[model samples]
Target: MTTTGLLGAALLAGLNVLPVQAAAAPSLPRDGGPAAEVLARQEVLDRLADEITRVPEHERSLVAGYAGHTVDPRHGHLDLYWHGRLPDHVTKVLAAAPTGVTAAVHEASYTLRELRAGRDRLVGAVVRGEAGAVWTSAGPLVDGSALAVGYTPDGGGRHGVATAGEVSARAAAVAGVPVTAVTAAASTAASTRHSDASPWSAGAELTTPGNGWCTSGFGGWRGTTAVLLTASHCGTSGTYRTGAGAVVGTATDSDTGLDTTVIDVNGTPSGKYFDGGWDNGSGYAKRVVGAGRNNVGDLVCASGAMSGIHCSLRITATDVAAEVNGQWRTDLDTATRTDDSTVAVAKGDSGGPVVASVNGGADMQARGIISAGTGNPVVCGSVAAPTTCWDSLRFVPIAPIVSKFGLSLA
Candidate 1:
């Protein structure tokens, strides 16, 4: 397998693939309509869906019949796709779901493993420059229906003669699956500035020695040594400092494929991250209790030095591949603002934390770290320096990073 292929395989088998079970029942609203009920039902359904998909290491074959799943938080049900017979464990979980939660089983034409293999084939073809220079990115659709291939009208600046339909057909031939061509938008790293004190917290601004700025992500331990996480694209090797010029840490290692870097801290590393606006001066901090994977329709929030906290974003896709900063990054996920008029992410938010509310919104479950901004650009009005925000964003899920680096949450 190629390097990208190997990385993708490792990510699929990483710790994040296993879902965490929710410890408590959801707190439904005191008085509301079906919309409110649907929202409340999501909390427990998310956990139950994860339980149904969990596979023991020795029982990896259990996933052979599994295709993909969609958590419809707005519709108050879980959709599971399968081919052939359902796994024994999956059947049990579905039967024991909470009273109010519903599980809808649908027969699928292809399994997730099969779809992933198809995706890898297409990506490998693109990498070798044999699949035409038209595709910017590609991944398996969450619906288990086809491969979602990204292409622009000008064929991503290489194959202008190719139409979207032609590109889709060509890609489908290579992937051995149905293909859905979507408009490809350009993406840029979100790195900029913020200021904070010692015991450096996540979401604070880090000045990369001569390489501009980026935000601090989750804090964890690399073996016995304390470390901070950030975007590898910010500066692979450098003495990172706070916006106040306080020495934060030094980048000791990084995974370019994952766009994550580990910094050996110079001072204390806090488990909390800033949650207020860009100019809030580190007054608000939220605890990071644990890490989890995001599913389609799940709600998540992002905090960046440039854009603060925006929690209305919904997960739109998972396990995607995208080209960012002239490099192909695999296993990326995309999310969009539920409210179209609001900004989801902006420049300088790269390496910041992407989290979901937990413990009644008092704490957060780490989902991923900000990677790049996609879709249309919006004006960033909070900062004096000119920067751009996007209605949608891409992130690198935190579970694989923690598992790959052998790190533990602090």
Candidate 2:
């Protein structure tokens, strides 16, 4: 696939297209025909994206089930993907694609929608304890045709047959989907980030009005009002207080179905995002210039009271679904170690800042916040002093949260 095709797939899979300034075409002469051509193509691509959003939910699902699409900005053509030869009806739909946007179809495996559905089924099974001893999450391959189920062996050195088998069966039941089991370690459960918290600042520890502990996300403002963002699971309403025992805000709105909320704070929340959380003596201060969208392969670092700043974690997947508080949550992004190292996201890190480094870490763009993980404890240290750790971390992208609440980052 061409670069444009790759970008199209990334957007389809819930990734943000890089800003125009980040694209390589900028190196080309602006007055040259190539530059003008690229800009025009970008405009058309933007229209196509808007059209996609306008598609009704029912029709959108059918389109997803039928195939995926990518636009070759250079050629101004849209390429559709499918497991086999493009079906007749799908081809017709492509032929009628938005004017100025040419269309073609390429054969692939299962559609992205199918893969997401399969993942949901498998996760739901585990949440209901139908998956037994397997407590990790699963996802679809890049082509969106197959599922990868993750698990760790039980204390008996065995991944129970019934549990693993059930997960596979559920995924396989999804038409044209296959399951691949992976022996991955599980992460630890959510825990408070710090025993000592600071004034209401991004990445500082705070207790939900209900007394549930969590880290605050990036602060925002609406004219004279100050707003605080945090994980929805933290609590919907109550007086949120700083670790220093000062009341900072009131939880006014929360969407428990999703992992985000907004608090009405009395004072202006700081625009500074803790680079290395208070725990990391190496951490410094960085101002959040703007909010950023996430994509697979992006290098992101997160800050929390427990873990401070852990960087070099590569985002592996978007559109992740997991069971949270007896409900299945979807549209989550995941980060994993790019190399074998001790860096991991842990409890009390929830609702903390996840940012993409810029200028080699001197500045940063706020990305998202820690939500949940595999819930499997990563054991480190010698046999005599085993220490529990976190494996992988999942976060809800901040773009959606900001859009949902109609707020701007401070």
Candidate 3:
């Protein structure tokens, strides 16, 4: 297992308690171009959420089914909602007995009326778990008790992790799981220096030997050092190392249940592929920047061991949850996407980075890490398709995760 998987697996093996929430991923188009497109995607995703809130539960599930394409599939193996999906699917992701686990939707992008009004809510409904209960002009605020960190990012301006009490009741109510208690989660402003990153994309032939078949996530700055990013579960548990298996540094502070970890690799097999995530959906394939706000039409992918379903997961936003290890966690939509893509992530995939490829480059951007969702090989657009696959997947964001531990990439 990678260091992160080893740690989480070991922690659960020991029976110690910790919060968990992982699964995530996507977005849209534009001017300055990548940035504008990201914002536009966010708007589209926001509209979808608005519509999703109005749909009834069953219908929400149906929409969730297709939209869930973005949330499922994790080469890293840390799907915060893995055990929290509709009881039946839960068994598929969770072990016979899981450790810290929780996941539920805290916000809806749309309302039923909105759907009827203009299908505008489709963007939000595509990613939301349930249709919204009530509505207000500025979208409603979620209840505190119902969230991991009490977050609500369904509308426009998506924030990082919500504070301990910032979640609104409406938001919490929409979440599928209980909202009694919550472990620390992402709270940092996801809008950091990464807003203007280059799309570090890659091709089939550019595989580097020592890098391992890993993915990427948001690059951040700890103090002054610029460190590459990925799920804590991606690296060796104890510290950072190189393809040679040599100890380099330690993971800053990983949140197991959250399925997020940062290797300080202050000096590991150091290269230079930017320091953070590059999660962007479709078009242009921009840099993997920003968190808590992903949208439709995004083209994201993860890399890890060749064993599992390691492939490109198009973003969808239905039946989503934002918790870690099963605990309510952050605001990023716990993603699910169609799994028919050729990408196959395996065991070693845990903690592997998921990069958003834009114009294409020598490498990929570090977006989110491999995490599980609810469906098996997510089935999108059409569940009845003879080849419909599962969609239980998750990829935890790096910023919120790091904030929870109060650690730095430095």
User: By TM-score, who's the top model here?
Assistant: 1
Candidate 3 lDDT over residue span 269-387, tens digit each: 22222222222222133333333223333445544322222333555432223433323332233333443443223323344445554332223344455554333333222111122
State the C-alpha lDDT per candidate. 0.74, 0.59, 0.33
**Residue pairs whose backbone atoms clash in candidate 2:** 82-108, 83-108, 186-376, 187-375, 187-376, 191-347, 191-348, 192-348, 193-348
Instruction: State in Å the error of residue 395, model 1.
Output: 0.8
In candidate 1, what are the lDDT values of residues 1-410, reduced to their tens digit?
01112123333233122232333443321111123344455566678767876632112224777766778655556767777777667766766666556556776777777777777787787678783657777877766778888877776667466778898898888889999887867677887335676676788888886657789999988888889999988988979988778888899999998999999997667788887677765357878888876777777788888777777678888778788877888888888887754588888889999987655455678888999998778766565257888988999988789878998976
The better-scoring model by lDDT among 1 and 2 is: 1
For candidate 3, the TM-score is 0.38
Q: State every prediction's TM-score relative to the real structure.
A: 0.87, 0.66, 0.38
| Candidates ranked by TM-score | 1, 2, 3
Better of 1 and 2 by TM-score: 1
Which of candidates 1 and 3 is the stronger one according to TM-score? 1
TM-score of predicted structure 1? 0.87
Rank ordering of all candidates by lDDT, starting from the highest: 1, 2, 3
